[model samples]
Target: MNDDRLEGAGGEDTEEHLLRSLPGCIVAAVGMVGIAGFVLFLVARIVRSLTT
Candidate 1:
């Protein structure tokens, strides 16, 4: 029952888990950057409008 081929039976599983989870991390990072950029752009536009 301890064969390496069995499910959830190796350090490789942890590495695989992390690899699978990487996409979520990448998506979150992109979303955060996009939101930050959008907010900053909006703020800059508002300031420009106010000054004019």
Candidate 2:
């Protein structure tokens, strides 16, 4: 028999999926920021080295 307790199943599933994915999203955002920072640092170092 079909389950009655899971009424509005689509919305519930979407909410649960979003909750599970939230951490991965945060990690991805942080990783992007970190990579950007590192690239900037490398570029600055290269520029400084060339000038010197």
Candidate 3:
């Protein structure tokens, strides 16, 4: 919002830092869901195999 803030040499990296971290954050969330799904699938397969 302030001009001095943006022109300053090393005041902040808020936007850039957020942009940089976005991909890693997304990957981590997706990876967690993927792992959970895989585990559930494995459990379902094991249950099916045991029942039949």
User: How do the residues 1-52 of candidate 3 rate in per-residue lDDT, one tens digit apiece?
Assistant: 4644454446476666667668989999999999999999999999999999
Q: What overall lDDT, based on C-alpha atoms, would model 2 receive against the true structure?
A: 0.79
Pairs with backbone N, CA or C atoms under 3 Å apart (clashes), candidate 2: none
TM-score: which candidate is best? 1
lDDT of each: 0.80, 0.79, 0.81
lDDT of 1 at 14: 62
Q: Write the per-residue lDDT of candidate 1 for residues 1-52, one digit (tens) a residue.
A: 3442353456667676667668989999999999999999999999999999
Clashes of each: 0, 0, 0
Name the runs in model 1 displaced over 4 angstroms.
1-12
TM-score, per-candidate, Cα-based: 0.72, 0.69, 0.66
- How much does candidate 1 score in TM-score? 0.72
Where model 2 places Cα greater than 4 Å from the true spot, the runs are 1-9
Sort the predicted structures by TM-score, highest score first. Answer: 1, 2, 3
Question: Which residue pairs come into collision in candidate 3?
Answer: none
Query: Per-residue lDDT for 13 in model 3?
Result: 69
- lDDT of residue 37 for candidate 3: 100
lDDT, residue 34, model 3: 100
